[model samples]
Target chain A: MKLEIELIYKQYVDYIYGFIYGMVQNKAVAEDLLQDTFVKVMKSDIDKIENMKAWLITVARNTVYDHWRREKRKLNLMPFIRRKRRDIDLKLDIERGIEKLSPKLKEVIILREINQLNYKEIADILDVEIGTVKSRLNRARKELRDSLEG
Target chain B: MNCSKIEELLSPYIDGELSRDEIIRVERHILECKNCEELLKDFQLIKEKVRGIEIPQPSLRIKKKIIGYARPRNYFLRIIFSTSLLTGLGALLVLTLGHQPYIAEEKPKEYYIMKEERTPYMEILYETEGDYILTNYEGGSL
Candidate 1:
């Protein structure tokens, strides 16, 4: 309710949305989870939070993982396809490549490249050591190379 | 380190995350190794492709929907709490107060079962008043 928190929400809403949308690849679900993320932040005691951005990303990442677990049970019977819109089709191809990544590698690539979070930020979000974050990122890059090439 | 070691570090090297010493080693190795040189080209190609791909913007409807959820966070939670309280009270009332009217509305039918406890003894025969009877075991006059 404070002016600062409201301003923060307004400023970062789009960035958080873009980051989550990149992970989920669905507009409706992404929007729902985005609202959920902000709602959680607003309800939490901010005095305890040292890094708001990393905390928000961590919340968004958990929401995405839960969504994935729920959807995986639904057993999607449809084959993956690049939709007809030229730009979207191309984008969809890139998305498919990201989807093909192992979960660990995918998370690293998404946090670093798509979310544009620094290595230290990603390290905090994932609750891993910095060296582990760097190594995972490197492996992710190599895997993305193989996916794009083959 | 050998070509394999340098090749393993190429991704981190490109990301500018490697230590200064590792950077120098990797750079020196790539200068001599053509295979790793090709690997670097392939890595760059992938990074460019991923970075260049445009991310789709969230639709306007989704934007409005998300904003709608955020706008009523406090009010929505209040409503949920009140509704839950009402639901619990209603259940308590229904459970505490027995369903008298509900049970009264429907009449239960009655059923009976028949059983015999004992049977009477049967009479074997009857004798006329004027008729004389003699016992076979002893002689008698009547």
Candidate 2:
């Protein structure tokens, strides 16, 4: 079991951490959520999981939402509170664009772009159909582009 | 489909997620539509930019935390130990209850079967002086 945990952590720590950071955009918060996600994994039946990477990402996604729920009062004002300190770098512009996206779009883009998961994997993670994944990804890409262009 | 619907397909087309027909349609539309072709270019650029977004690495403490999480717990060890102990006990009980010394209280059924084979015309004799003698019904005993 210890070996199992170590092996899993070693194999997936970076991607899982990157995913959380991508979704939350906070190093501190992402770290906390990563820990929380692993803790939840530790408590459950890890041995029975067939797809560890997908499962970990799913847990991390849930952890992100759980954090949002806990911080609902503060987060509800985030869009209004978040002031634009736009960087000229197109990369930074898109990152900001992604940050401003609604959670549904945010998740699909992050899971698709950052994690580089296929449509099927995104569908599985989001619990939606592949058609929905495709449409959401298209909309997400367009929104990000439009947000930066305008 | 209109340009917007065609535009909706640009992402999947870029990712190679579109079906063959959809891909053909997107390609055909892009050949004629300047706006969508440009939008496709922008979406590609956005995808590249998103990929370019600096993925932050977690602090060393998180790695340490993960390593720390990998440490063996007493409960896991306890569960293994208990399971093995129960299995051993079960094996022992099966061996104890199922195994016994065999004793033949009477002649085996095969002996009676052999004895029953003798008939009015059949002959059976022990060496020299026998337990019984069987003779032909003509009764010429030699």
Candidate 3:
């Protein structure tokens, strides 16, 4: 059991971490979410998971959403608190633009571009049709390009 | 194909997800339509930039911490067993050797301090201190 979990960790660590980081845009938060993602994976019945990578990515995505929901709640409670912006490098301007996108658009872009998951895989993860994925990706690219240009 | 139809197919076309017939139609339309061609170029640039964005690797400490959580309880037993075995071996060696302490000649302690200095052969275009130090020279770091 330990060996199986370790193997899964070694296999999907980069993909899971990249996906989480792409969503959160914060290394510390991403790492915490990554830990939570694997813990969820460990608790799940591994035998039932047909697509391990997609499963792990879905868990990571949910973990990010949960973090965001908690953050949103906290902000609502303390409306005066403001989140500080981190220093983003010039090279990461594209990534910063991605971070500014709406959650639905940002998710498709990350799943497609960063994680390099196929349309079918992304559709499966997001529980949306392939057409919806296509439209979302198109809108996401358009928004990202406009932001960068402006 | 109309421009709007072509625009709808643009994402799938760029992703190579379109059917062969659709790909041919889009290609033919793009050749004659300047707007669609420019849109394709823009999408290509967006794809390139997104793909080029660097993803930071999770720290090794975090990896260890997460993997440690999944370790089975038997791992502890294995560690304890191995430790006991080593201790037993040590006791057996001591018992066989008798309590006579072996004395060895003492040697003076030697200390050497080493300093590393990097002399820039050419101009340093960029330098960042971290896991990766990317430097660009007149020619190239490579």
Q: Which pairs of residues collide in candidate 3? A: none
**Model 3 over residues A1-150: C-alpha lDDT tens digits?**
778888988888888888888887776678778888888888889988888888888888888889888777766775665434334443376877887899999999999988998899999999999999999999998898888888
**Residues B48-90, model 3: lDDT tens digits:** 9988877888899888877777755587887997899999999
lDDT of 1 by residue, B6-125 (tens): 876877777787899999998888888898888888877766666665666656755454444443346887799789999999999988786645567676754322221110111122
Q: For this target, which candidate reaches the highest DockQ against the unseen true structure?
A: 3
Binned by DockQ into CAPRI classes (incorrect, acceptable, medium, high), candidate 2 is incorrect
- Model 1 CAPRI quality: incorrect
Chain B alone vs. reference chain B, TM-score for every model: 0.51, 0.49, 0.51
Model 1, runs deviating above 4 Å: A2-5, A76-92, B70-142
DockQ-based ranking: 3, 2, 1
The better-scoring model by TM-score among 1 and 3 is 3
Which candidate wins on TM-score? 3
- Per-residue CA lDDT of model 2 for A46-146, tens digit only, reads 98899988999999998998887766655464434332233223336776788789999999999888899999999998899998998888888878877
For model 2, how does the per-residue alpha-carbon lDDT over B1-142 read when each residue is reduced to its tens digit?
6998897788888888878999999999999999999999998998898888887777887777766776457888879978999999999988987896556696554221113212111233233332344432234332
Candidate 2: deviation at residue A54, Å? 1.4
Candidate 3 has a DockQ of 0.25
> Which candidate wins on lDDT?
3
What's model 3's lDDT at A114?
A: 87
